[model samples]
Target: MNLFADIRLAVIAALDALVAEGGLPAGLDYANVAVEPPRDALHGDMATNAAMVLAKPAGAKPRDIAEALAAKLGADARIMAAEVAGPGFLNLRLAPGVWADVVRAALKAGAGYGRSSLGKGVKVNVEYVSANPTGPMHVGHTRGAVFGDALASLLDFAGYEVTREYYINDGGAQVNVLARSAYERYREANGLEPEIREGLYPGDYLIPVGEALKAKYGESLLGQPEEVWLADLREFATEAMMGMIREDLALLNVKMDVYSSEKALYGTGKIEAALKRLEDLGLIYEGVLEPPKGKLPEDWEEREQTLFRSSQFGDDVDRPVKKSDGSWTYFAPDIAYHFDKVERGFDQLIDVFGADHGGYVKRMKAAVAALSENRVPLDIKLIQLVKLFKNGEPFKMSKRAGTFVTLRDVVEQAGADVTRFHMLTRKNDAPLDFDFDKVLEQSKDNPVFYVQYAHARVASVLRKAAEAGVDVSDAALGAADLSLNTHPAELELARKIAEWPRHVEIAARANEPHRIAFFLYEIASDLHALWNRGNEEPALRFVQDDAAITSAKIAQARACAVVISAGLGILGVTPAEEMR
Candidate 1:
C-alpha cells in the first residue's frame, strides 16, 4: 500500500475535522496541499504544507492554523508526533509500528510491492528507435531503445495500457542508398568486380544480403539496368536491414508491439486523408516561409508550397506538407503516421527521439496537436548520446557497424543487464558515459553493482535462514513479528521501502523512468548501509540466535529485495540473485 498517500489522506481528514469543529474556515481548497519527505531528515519523517497553503485562502494566521492542525494530526495512531515547524509547515514522525507494517506489506506483495495505478489504465502508445532501415542499430539508437523500453515498462507498471511501437524509415532516400550498396555486393557475389562508389553503404554486413540476392535471382538480375532491379533490391535490402535491426534489439531484450512501415503509408490514401482533415479545419495553406533567423541555409528557397499552420499550435513556424514539385515532403508522411496513431484512439502518445532530432520536436508536436485536436497529448523525449570508454580511453568503433558502435557490440561486450542499467544511470536527456571497466567493477561507486549486491545479499540471508531451519517462505516472513525490527538502522530501511510506491507514481507522472533508477540506487544505499552496520552489531545481523528474531530481521531484508526486484524490472534488468 502507498503509506505516503494514506498519510496524506489522514492529513486531509484531520483538516476536515478542524473545519467541522469550527477551528478553521468553513470552505478551504485543499487541492494544493502536499505531504512529502522533509527537506532535512533532522526535522521529521514527512512535512505537510497544509497550513502554509491554506492560510491566505482561509483568512487565518499560518502559525495558528498549523498549531490547530498539529493537534488534530497528533491524535492519529499512526503519527507519533505532529510538530509545527517554521511559519506553518507541519512535520510528522510516524509510529514505529507503521514502519514495521511497511516491511510486512512489502514481503506480502513481493514483486508487486511498488506497482501503481496512477495512469488509470489509459491507453498510451510509445514510439521509439525509428531509425532508417539502412544498417544495424548504432549506439545512438541503442540509447533510445533502452530509454523507451524502460519507459513503456514503467507506464505498464503504473497501470497504463502501453504499446511499444517502431516506425520504420524505409520510404526515404536512405533505403535507395541501401539498395544500391547491396547491389555492389550482389555483383561481388556473382564473381564480378563490384563498384563500391561514393554515397553507397560500404559496410561488410550486407555481404550476406548480396549472397542471398545471388541465390534468389542468380544471373537473371545480373544484366538488368537500374530501372529493372532498383525497386526489387530496395524492398529486399530494407527487409534484410529490418531483420538485422530486430536481432540487434533482441540483444538488449527489447520487443516492439508494432513495427509500422513508412512505405505502407505512401499509396494507401492515409497521407491524403490526414492532410484533408487538416485542410478541412483550415490548418492547411499555401505559403512561403521566411528565411531562418541566422544565416540562410544552403538549400533555402522562397517558393510557395502547401503548408500546415503549425505556428498556431506553438511551433516556431508553419511547416510544409508538400514540396513545390507536388511530391510529399518528409513531414507529410510523418504527419500521416501520427494521424494513424490518433485514429487508433490512444489517450496519450510518447515519442523517443535522439538528441539530433531536437529540431523536429516542436513541429511534430504541432502536427499531433492539430491532428488530435488537442484531445491527445504527445510527449517527445530526446535521448542524448552515450560515449563509450574503456579504462580512460575512448572505445574503438564496431567492426560490424562500420562508422559507429553497434548495439549488439555493446551488449556482447557488457551483458544485456549491465548495458541496460548503465545506460539509465543518467537521465534520458543527460549525457552518459559507459565505461566498460567502471561498470563491471565490484565497487559501491558503480550503482548497478551496488544495487545488485544489495539484492544478492538478501538472497544470501535467505539461504542462511533456510539453513538455520527457520521458515523463510513469503507467508512466514510476512507474518513475522516485525515489531522486533525497531532498530534505527532497520527502521530507516523500512521507511525507504515505504517510499517505493510514492516513487513509482512520481516517476510515472513525470514520464521519466530514469527516476526509478535513482530511487533504486537510494533504497539500495540504505540497504547497504544497514548491512554494513550489521557487521559491527550482532543484534543488527539478519540471522540471529533465536528463530523469531531471525525471522523478523530476514523479513526486513526480504522486503528490500522485493522492492529492488520491482525497480529492476521496470529498468528491464534481472535482479542479481548471487554476486560473482
Candidate 2:
C-alpha cells in the first residue's frame, strides 16, 4: 500500500524491461534510482530519477533514456502522464483511482497502515536514561527518556525487536557518595545533626531513604564506622534511589525492559573476559598515554596503564581500561556491559546519552567494535539540553532535587503526552525550549495541540456521519466508491496519506523519531487546510447530500486520522479522541 514504493518498483521494472529489450546496457546498477514526489506538486504527483541515474552507466544520453522510460511508464494504467523535466527527471501524474486506492488502503489498515518491516525483526537493545542510582530523574534525563522511548516504539513500528534498557551507574564512586549522604540522613532520623557535606548529594529526596533504613536496621547502623555500614547502606540506598527513579519514569510513561547494573559485572569475570577478548585481538595493551593536548589536569602525568587501542577503531586515542592505581577505569565496566549485550545476541545496539557525554561516544563505539570484533554496530545519540520556561520566563529549579528540575515537575505541569510530544519537536541533538505557556496554547503554533486537534476533528466528522445514518465503519468506508473524492483539495490530502508508509521507513532507518513528529505535523497541516477549504465549497464537506459521496469523503478523513493515530503512537503520545 506504499504508493511511493510501488511507483519506485514500477520504475525499476521499466528499467529492467529496457535492459531486456536491448534499449539500455545490461547490468546497470539501479540501486540509486528513486521515485519520489516532485519538488513542485503542480508539475506532477511523483518524480523519478531512473533516466538520470542510469544514463552514464548505460552509456546513453539522459534525455534519450528519459523519453523511452516515459513512453514505457505512460502505458501503465496507474500513471496518467509521464513527462520528462530538467533533462532527465520523469514527473508522473497518477490516475485519480490511484489516490482513491490510497484512501481505501489507509481505512483498511487503520493504525497499522504505516507499520514497516524494515528491520526484519532484528533484535536491537536501546539503552537510555541510564542515570546514576542517586536521585529522581532530572530534566536532562527526561529528554533522553522521551527520545529513547519514542525511538524504541518507532523501531518497533518498523519491525525491530526492541529491548529498552537502563544501565545503572551503581558500580561507580558516585553510589558510595550516595551511601554516605544517606547515612547522614539516617543519623538525622535518629535525632543527630546531619552534616551536609559539600561533595555529597544534598537533595532532600533521600530523607525518606533514611527513614526506611532506620525502620530496617533500627539503631544498629546509626553509629557504625564507614567500613561497617558503607556497603550495606550503598546497596539499600541504591535500591531506594532506583525505586524513586522508576516512579519518576512511570510519571513520564517510560518503562525499561532491562535494568543492567555495573556492579554486577564486578568479580564475575565479565570485565576480565571482555578485556581478554580485546587482548586476543591485539587491541589491549599496557601503555602510557600522552598528556591531553589542551590544559592538562593538575594531577596529569604519563603513567603505564592497561589500555584499549581505541584509535584503531576511529577513536581519538587509545583509551585506558585500568588506571595506574590498579583499579578499573570507568570505561572498563561499560565495555564489559556492552560485551554482555553482544553475547546476548542482539543484532544492533543504541545508546542515548546526554550531550555532555559526547566525548565518550567515540571511545565507547570503539570498545563495542573491538569487543564484538566489528560484528555488531553501535549507535550513540547525544541528546541536548532542554531549557524550561514558565509564562515566557525561565523556570526555577526543584527544591526536592536541590540543583535541577525533576522529570516529575515537567510532567505535572504539562502532562505526560504534551511533554513527550513537545520534547520530540526538536532533534535530539538540538536544544529545545519547553515553554509551559506556548505548548498548551490551542493554536497551530503548538504542534502537539494542532496534531491532536486534527485527530479530534476527524473523530467529530465520523460521529456526525454515523448520526446522519451514513455507514462509516472501516469496512464500509474502505469499500466506498472513493472516486467521488476527485476534487483537488481532497486528492491533495490523499497524496499526503499515501506518503505515510514511506515516511515511517525513512524515520525508522535514520533512527530519528523526531521525523515522526514532523510528519504528523505536516499531515495535520494538510488535514486542516482541506477542512478549512470545505467552508467555502459545501461539496467538499464530509457530510454531502448523497450517502455514497459522504461515505467516500468520510473514508478519506478516517484514513488521515488512522495515519495520525499511528504516528502519534510511535511518538508515545496518545491520539486525542476529542481535545478538551
lDDT string, candidate 2, 1-580, tens digits: 8899999988888988888999998888988988888889999999998888888878899999999999999779999999999888999999999998899888888878978888998999999999999998999999999999999999999999999999999999999999999999998898899999899998899999999988998889866789999999999999999999999999888889999999999999999999999999999889999999999899987889998999999999999999989999999999999999999999999999999999999999999988888989999999999999997789999999988999999999999999999999999999999999999999999999999999999999999888988888999999999988888889999999999999989888889999999999999999999899889889888888898888889999999999999999888899998988
Candidate 1: where are CA atoms >4 Å away? none
- Return the TM-score for each candidate structure: 0.98, 0.98
Local distance difference test, each candidate: 0.92, 0.93
Best by lDDT: 2
Tens-place lDDT digits, model 1, residues 1-580: 9999999999899999988988888878889898999999889899999999999988899999999999988888999999999899999999999988898888888888888888898999999999899999988888899999999999999999999999999999998899999999999999998898889888889999999999999978887898899999999999999999999999999999999999999999999999999999999999898998988899887899999999999999999899999999999999999999999989999999999989999999999999999999999999999999987999999776668888888888889999999888888999989899999999999999999999999999898778879899989998989999878888889889999999999999888998999999999999988888988998898888988999999998999999999999999999988999
Total clashes for model 1: 0
TM-score of 1: 0.98
